[model samples]
Target: MHHLTGHRNIVELRGAYEDRHSVNLIMELCEGGELFDRIIARGHYSERAAALLCREMVSVVHSCHSMGVFHRDLKPENFLFLNNKEDSPLKATDFGLSVFFKHGEQFKDLVGSAYYVAPEVLKRHYGAEADIWSAGIILYILLSGVPPFWADHPWIREDGEAPDKPLDITVISRMKQFRAMNKLKKVALKIVAENLSEEEITGLKEMFRSLDTDNSGTITLEELRSGLPKLGTKISESEITQLMEAADVDGNGTIDYSEFVSATMHMNRLEKEDHILKAFEYFDKDHSGYITVDELEEALKKYDMGDDKTIKDIIAEVDTDHDGRINYQEFVAMMRNNSPEIVPNRRRMF
Candidate 1:
């Protein structure tokens, strides 16, 4: 909070007193109380009001990020109106879990409230994007009066509008993965209930789009957490984190289209001779017929796959012939294995 002392939306820290046992902060008082109470005292506000609040919330986020600070735990209760006036500025408080971060740094500590935590945080690898994830969820709650993943809530059930768009394929991987079942379970139970149409997966509305404000062409971890509830699937935050790490085949910290399809596509399609060769050719640039360690790093680095050491480790393990390079035969064998595309674990991966 001291780092953000002069920000318009952040609560100003007047002073601090430190003792042997603790440190006390003198903060500007906000007599208007918590945001939820304000909403409940009246009712859900108009979309215009919600839009205004959303902008303010995002501004708080931008203020923090611009100052190299990350508010690790952001939820409705952390926001307070400065005065009783309707237009009083909302101040962001509670820096208990906030931390200063440098660009390209990744935090491993998992600390956040249940509903607003991003999946990457749970997976123990995240950056500034994680805080953005939290703010987006807060925006979703302000707009809908309920968390997006909380399918059991009255607001979720009461919302009966048809889905306006088909979720992206990457989003589908997240929704299906988070549905508390592996693909085999769905197949075993004859569960086509997700409206398994190739054209559109039904029963979800504006789910992924809520946080894709930039439409940057990749699935944000924030979108996954916010969308899971619409599918009526609830899981422990730990499981949600695991679901992301499990599906992120490239280890790029975000799931992309190829990673999604590589992780979930049918075996027949995956093992097609042409498909396997194409996959190899992707890495064996220059049509060299062999994936040298340099070739491996170059290909994987393009996807921001992982560090050089991890990429080299993959090359070493996949080169079954001990040739310091991966040939078509070795590549095919690895791809044919039960689960291969996993970047973290190569002993049993694609």
Candidate 2:
């Protein structure tokens, strides 16, 4: 909290005193009370008001992410207003479950409250994106006056048993209504569901380590500007800043491995997809949008990939429709699904 004191949206840590037995932290006083209480007192809030509050929440979270901090426990009760005024800024408090993380690192500890806890956090191996999930929960609660998920909700079952109660239709209706009201909130919800596979994450970590020339966990601006050219690409300072801003999540001046990976992961995917398409085009000699058994044999022969039988077996597995040919969709799926093997051996056109 002390390190994060300067941020307007965070509760200021005034001072701290440590004694033999214990330590005491003197923090800012928010007379207006908890955010939940304030919301109840308002009885109802306009979409504009909710959006304003949500923006403030994102700003603070963004600041925390920029600094490599994660407030694992983010809930309405943790937010307090400075005063009773209409514009009393909401400040995030309670750092008990908060943690600082290096770039590309993953946390396995299940530390947050259930309602605001992200799904990946529960599974472990979560990063800064967990906070974004919590923020989305807060946004849902702000709009609906109830959490989107609840411990007692009938839809949830223990022991993997089917629930006796019918799933609530109202919950689905509310979700639809919420999505209709806030498009950005819909995007945030989608982000909560987005996750990189373990293999992709591992590959990204390796990529980050390679770019970190000094072996430092974080990438400096100098390294970013100079290193890309070594990979046969050049980026201007402004572009570098934009990349940093997009990936840095924590406002820290340097890019941690996580930031580096997150920022470039999409680019990496696109490049792989391009390569897959090119490979497909190469095999589709007749421009028929499909690779027949003959084309597959010919393409495999060019690379000395496998025996005739081996090539046929490979195509047989990918030919889901059993049309005796692999269409562009099937070909792309095969490449992506077997990327670990295919990508490493992919022939570079250049």
lDDT of 1 at 220: 57
Model 1, 341: alpha-carbon shift in Å? 64
Candidate 2 lDDT score at position 161: 35
lDDT of each: 0.62, 0.63
TM-score, candidate number 1: 0.43
Candidate 1 segments exceeding 4 Å error: 151-350
List residue ranges in candidate 2 displaced over 4 A: 151-155, 158-350
Clashing pairs in 2: 65-249, 65-250, 66-249, 66-250, 66-251, 66-252, 67-250, 67-251, 103-258, 104-258
RMSD of each: 20.6, 23.3
**Native-referenced Cα lDDT, model 1:** 0.62
Best by TM-score: 2
What are the per-residue Cα lDDT tens digits for candidate 1 across 295-326? 76675565455466766667666677788987
Residue 117 local lDDT, model 2: 90
The digit string of per-residue lDDT tens for model 2 on 35-130 reads 866544342356899899999999999999888898899988899999988899989999898889887889988798757899898888799898
